[model samples]
Target: MKLTNKHFRIAEIMAAFFTGSQTEQDERDFEEWAKESDRHKAFVNRLLNPEEYEENRRALDKFQVEEAWSKMDKRIGDTKVRKLSSWRSVVRYAAVVLVLLSAGVYYWWNGEEVREEVPVLYQIAAGTTGARLTLGDGSVVDVLKDRAVELKEVDGTRIVTDSIGIDYSTRETVDTAEIMNTVQTLTGMEYMLTLSDGTKVFLNAETKLKFPTKFQKEERVVVLEGEAYFEVSKDVAHPFIVKTNGVEVKVLGTSFNLRSYSDENSIATTLVSGKVAMFAGENSEEIVPGEQAVYMKETGKMDVKPVDVTLYTAWHTGKFIFRNETLEEMMSYLARWYGVEYRFIDEGAKKLQIGARLDRYNNMNPIIEMLKKTGLVNITQVDNMLYISSTE
Candidate 1:
């Protein structure tokens, strides 16, 4: 029988299901369709069986998976994008590769629990939700935990600390002198800061933001060392610029997220709303909402593309989201937030894709337990280091 577009779509859904990335509703739909007729069952069986669809598989060269994914992403839309929970699902056939890789099969998604067995592990301490404030004079103050203590006045800018966030609003524009202040968070900690110019920033764990206590008349520039989400206050006269390792993001009255981790390969600047211009070396690109600018560290080349802004900004909402992300990619975030070391026993395991969502503030024990439950990779802890290996 000649396969149509509908058959290809069903095959895609089947790949998602076997990889444990499909949603409960998707599973129900597939099951319902499977029970409808023997033809449907045979169709699904043909998809599941590698030999049946071998001739139909499209030839994809190295890195062509990303292109296929882009087409599939356009077809599926961002709403259905899910995080994989396991890496056990493997694709050996070329036809399955078209389905698997197009859906970002490196990230495994296990919708339901495969078994009731829980791995043996000690409860690890959760990350702290606190940050340290460095004044212009180089004095460090623990603001989150010690909110009651009176902080030293910085150029008459009152820094107020509440449970929700840290506010640095000036009653009057007293000092135009640029005195830089920094806020830093360690592993497993996050912070929210309101700048003197009313610009709000959310700093992620192991992140740092350095900004002026007072903004200059022409421009508002800040140096960032880690990941942060910015809500820039409208100042048409002054452009807000965030400078990181290889890129600079310029905005005016906009909200966006920038991630430039040292361990990561690229620096990603994701725009949530409004507009922003990203500059890397001589290259510059303007991106609007739902767009991201990725600056490759090695080549110093910047590429802008549309993205799901929510996934990039999920950290600000106290969540960690991985959509078609690899184990190495996910572990980099985990290592920073949990302050742990990761060693891969199998190199192939590092390339395994995973999709899942978990509370960022949760203890490492539960997170490790969930990964173990997927039965894709074995996670063992020795001191602060986590050893990950393919179960197969």
Candidate 2:
């Protein structure tokens, strides 16, 4: 029989089953198709293990994406001269085209073959150096790596772009209307900023930092929306304060990592050096180095506990250190940096706990492969969305 779109859909259903992401109805449909006829069963088996079809496997291995796209374009241009055949032929042609476009020969066709190799070269990549800077005068600037532009000269302070991030060193501390500036990092992007007072801020993905172009004499305060690692400059007279999500971190000449994502249940502040005081409404708590303060957004309650500082600060170092994190928790962090959507098939899969350290800068595919290898969870990528289910 000629290949059709039905065949391609059946292949996808088999994939979902192997990945453990198949719904109850999908499992029933798959089983019905398998028992329908001997030809259907054989086709499904070949899709499950493409090594059974040597010609197709070899064709996949030889398929070069760039050449395939060029050839497809030429074919499309010449389609008027040569009328295409039946829908079955079109489906077969489309299948081959999709296989070439999906990257890698093995993963596109065969499921078991993917088990032996790492498919980390995914379409979704990690965050890079880019941020939106809103200057004091209500003007915005896009700050990216190697894109240098002079922002402005507030009073005597000159805000300019350097090789890495924005730099503001030479500023006159004159009271020419206190100028407030905001820098925001979009999803799949991060940035570094050096404030006028030499305080360095390393912003994480989907974070925003609002500060003055030049700080007042009494205090240095910045409002944070998401997550950031701050290396506050030493000023005995002027204390540095970070306000975020109804909580504030007060410090003087210290470093800390603060995570205040809106989706999270609590705002976590981990001190790396010196000390930090976390305040929420009427309650407040003091935490020292190696300690974390978790402030619940709903109840406005703060709890201080000892934590591994490295786990909280690893994002800036191009690493993700998860210490016994749930599958849902891990995927939530991954989704932000990689700019992908994820869903668990069941509640059990979401709660499955695992511990692994991965290179945050790497693509999404390998990380999913690694998670699958652990036998804790099974992962399947449908377009940019990742579907996860319990291996049990």
Candidate 3:
């Protein structure tokens, strides 16, 4: 049977369920996704939780399950991608080799030692929100906790929460030399870290930020891959530095977001406050608030432009914002966040673009809703692939 996009989506959920949701958090996550929309829930019921569908969990796999589903993200009348979901679980025969290896690779062939790979990973089950953090210390922290755990307390630092928001006091502290290193997030996790200098760092999923627990006498710096946001602490004596995809952001005190996902083709740095000097391996430009710096990996080229800062940093606010973005771009984030599979079956579908914003931790129906509004496309799921087609 031809795999429809509906079937592909159903299979992604099944993969999440079959992969094992042993932890209490996992169970809660499944429930959250299960209740997001009637379509999503009904799809889950018909192809996943039922015993009948469970009986045929061997037909869904085609290397492009996620991409395929991106093709058929819309719904078809009574075609029941749900039915294909159960029968197609076993179809992915060749996916064993294509692991999305984001971390553990050096930013450069002869890069610094700080770029070594960490062993732990954060995986999000399908359709749920929140992420698990794997620290370099071999400790795991759940960032979604109602109250964040102070893994350790810095001397002379205090946490103050008010209408102005929480403040970390840096009255005084000893300059004891501790092992400073990089911390990378697994695919399912994003993180927020406060450096010794009081600079706040926000990480996107599967990003690695390598920094010292304490600053060296010479500099305070961190390397990144994937995406992260920074609210720089003021320090005239030293500066804050963020490294990603071979580009560097040097600032004395500022706030910005760096997006350099491995799966993505470009490295983007958006400045929200203060100022930023964005330098590729060579070219340099200064970016102020409301501006962005984009780096293309292939040509080592860059473009610094002005944009809506809110759109660039919206992901940090638990929102996925897209501004005239392409369908492929949206699907990439979906593949990571929802942990769903896709099959980009429509060659020309890549030309379709969208501009929308939806809650990061919310159900995915909103994305589909916007897709339907475009009127240029149609979606259907066959087995584990979503086939998006152009009306023209």
lDDT of each: 0.70, 0.73, 0.57
User: Where is model 2 more than 4 Å wrong at Cα?
Assistant: 1-122, 172-175
Candidate 2, 1-392: lDDT as tens digits = 23333444555465455445668887887888779777666555554442333344444445444544444445444343133332122232233333322333323323333222223433777677899998777888888878887856556667787668888766755658777889999989988989988999999999999998888769888999999999999998999999988888899989999999987999999999998898999999999999999988888788899988999999998899998888889888888899998756446788878788889888877788788788766565545666565544
Indicate whether candidate 2 or candidate 3 has the larger TM-score. 2
Q: List the candidate 3 regions with Cα displacement exceeding 4 Å.
A: 1-144, 147-176, 181-183, 381-385
Summarize candidate 3's per-residue lDDT along 1-392 as a digit string, tens digits.
22233333433344445434235654666677667767556545544443543222222222223433332333212245345453234222111101111111111112111122223322323332234434445665444523444444343333332222223433356555444445555555565656667788767666777766566555578878778888988787887777776778889888898888776788888988898898887788898899998888888888989899898788777888888887877778776666555564334566788888787876555565568578755544322334454443
- Clash list (residue pairs), candidate 2: 120-366, 156-172, 157-170, 157-171, 157-172
Winner of 1 and 2 under lDDT: 2
What is the RMSD, in Å, between candidate 3 and the native fold over all Cα? 16.3
Quote the positional error of residue 205 for candidate 3 in Å: 2.3
Cα deviation at 149, candidate 2, in Å, is 1.7
Per-prediction TM-score to the true structure, in the order listed: 0.67, 0.70, 0.60
Scored against the true structure, residue 323 in model 2 reaches a CA lDDT of 86
Worst ten in a row by lDDT for model 3: 100-109
The order by descending lDDT is 2, 1, 3
Q: Assess candidate 3 and give its TM-score to the true structure.
A: 0.60
- Candidate 1 worst ten-residue window by lDDT: 107-116
Total residue pair clashes for candidate 2: 5
Residue 62 lDDT, candidate 1, scale 0-100: 29
